[model samples]
Target: MSTKQIEKSTTEIQIPKDVKVNLKGSMLQVQGPLGKVYKNFKKIPVLIQINDNKILLRKTGERKKHQAILNTAKSLIQTLCTGVVDGFTIKMKIVYSHFPVTVKVEAKKVLIKNFQGERAPRISMIKGDTKVVVKGDDVIITGPVLTDVSQTAANIQLKSKVKNKDHRVFLDGIYRYSKSKGIEE
Candidate 1:
C-alpha cells in the first residue's frame, strides 16, 4: 500500500482598529463603521485563535492546500477591514454601435434608453449609498461598500448584453471599464 503525505503552513493576521471580528465555529462576522460582513467556511482544518487585539490563523495537519485557504481567509479579513475603513468604488462604460444609448439615474433606479431601439427602457435597482451617473459614454458607480457598487454596475451591464448575436457585430452594450476596491472585469 502507498501512503499519502500532506504539508501545511501557518499565518497570522491582525485585526484593524476599525474592524471588529466575531467567530463562531467556522463562520466569521466582521463589522465596522460601514457595515457588517459574514462568511462561513466548511471543514476548515486550520485553527483560528483570537486574542485581545490580534487574530491568529494556524494551519494544522499536513495538508498543503490549507495554505491557500489561509491566504483566502487573510484576504477576506483584509477586505473587510479596508471596506469598513474607506469603502470601495467601481466604474463602467456604456457603448453603442447603431444607436447611441442614453443612461440616467433617477432616485434609486438607473435607466437606459434607446438601447437596441427597444420600446421599453431598462432599469436597475441601486442599493445602500450606491450612486450611478452617466457622463457622456462613461457610467460612474460609487458606494460605501464594494458589493453594492459592483453588483449595481453588473446589473446594468447584464441588462444591456446582446444575446444570440455576434459580440463583434452587435457591439452596442454597457461594459465595465475599471473597478477599485472590488472585483471587476
Candidate 2:
C-alpha cells in the first residue's frame, strides 16, 4: 500500500492599493496611509509570502497545531494590513455616579484621579505605540496596531474597575463603547 500525505492548508489575503507589505526574513512590516505595523513570525511553524498584491500563508503539515498557527498568522497579517490602512481606534466613555473621575495621560501611563473618591490616583501603563486622548467624558485611543490600541483601552477600563461593591449601584469607571477597523464586540 502506498501512503499519501495531506496537502498543506493555505490562506490568501489581497493587498490594498495604498498599503505596502515588506517581508524581511521572518519579520513582516506593513506601511500605509494611516501608519505602519510590524510583527515577527520566525518562531511560528508557517510560511508567509507576498506575491504581487496578495499575501500567501501556508503550513507544511496538516496537523491541528499547525492549522491553528496558520489561521492565527493569517488573521494577524490581515489585521496588520487593515491597521496600517484604516488604523484602529477604541472609544471609551467615562461614567461616574458619585465622584467625578478625571483621566489624564502622563508619559506612558494613564492617571485616574479621584476615582470613586480615592485619595491616591490609580495609574495604568500604556502598552505598545498607543495614543490616548481625553475630551470631556470621551476617551479616544488610537494606534496603527490593533492589539496595542485595544490593550491600552482595556488597561484603562481595568484600572477604574469598582471593587467590593455592587457593579450596578457603583457604575463609576471607564467603559469601551466602540472599536473600529472591522473589529468590534
Candidate 3:
C-alpha cells in the first residue's frame, strides 16, 4: 500500500478528575493523586494537545512508522493518566528448588541471598520512586509510574537469573506472577 493511503491517525484519552497535564515543547508532565510522570517525546514528530479533560494525539504523516509512533504516544499518555489515579503494582514470586533463597529490600536495592548457594548476595538496584516489599516468598513492587514498577521487578528477576544451568532442572529464580493497577492490599 502507498504511504499516502496510510492516512493520519488521531487518538483521544480522557483525563481523570484529580489529574493535571502540562506540556512544554516535546516534554509532557502528568500529575495525579498518586504522583507525577514526566515523558519526553522529542524523538517522535507528533502533536499533543490537552483540552479540558481530554488528551489528543495526532500524527499527520501517513507513513507506517508515523502511525506506530502515534499509537505509542497515545498509550504512554493513557498510562500516565492511569498511574496518577490508581498507581501501579507488580507481584513477583521467589522460587528455589535446590537451595532456599532469601530476599531483602535495602535502601535503593534488593538483595538476593543464598541464591544458587552463592556466598555474596546479588544486588538489584531500584530506580525512581519504586518500593520493594518482601513477604514470605512473595515480592510486592509498587510505584506511581508503571515504568519504575516494572523496571524494579525486572531488576529483582534478573538478579536471580541462573547462567550456564539447565532451565528445566534449575528453575530457581524470582518470577513476576502478576501486574495490576492500584496499590497492593
Taken over the whole model, the C-alpha lDDT of each candidate is 0.75, 0.86, 0.88
| Model 1, residue pairs in steric clash | 6-62, 7-62
Better of 1 and 2 by TM-score: 2
lDDT of 2: 0.86
* Top candidate, metric TM-score: 3
lDDT tens readout by residue for model 2, 1-185? 12332334777889989999999999998999877778998898888889999999888676788888988888898888888777788999999987888998999999999999999999999988788889999998888898899889988999999999999888899999988773232
Q: Which stretches of candidate 3 lie over 4 Å from their true place?
A: 1-8
Q: Estimate each model's TM-score.
A: 0.73, 0.88, 0.90
Structural RMSD, model 1: 4.8
Whole-model lDDT, model 3: 0.88
Q: Any runs in candidate 2 off by more than 4 Å, and if so which?
A: 1-8, 182-185
Candidate number that wins on lDDT, 1 or 2? 2
Instruction: Summarize candidate 3's per-residue lDDT along 1-185 as a digit string, tens digits.
Output: 55545434777888888999999998999998887789998987889898999988888687778888888888888888888889899999999988899998889989999999999999999989888889999999988889989988888888899989888889999999899999985
lDDT of 3 at 154: 86
- Report the CA-based lDDT of candidate 1 relative to the real structure: 0.75
Give lDDT tens digits, candidate 1, residues 1-185.
Answer: 12422223556677878788898988877788767766665565668877876778876645557677777777766766777766776778788878779988899998888888887889888876776777888888865566667788888988898878898889888899787863222
Worst 10 residues of 3 by lDDT: 1-10
Order of candidates by lDDT, top first?
3, 2, 1
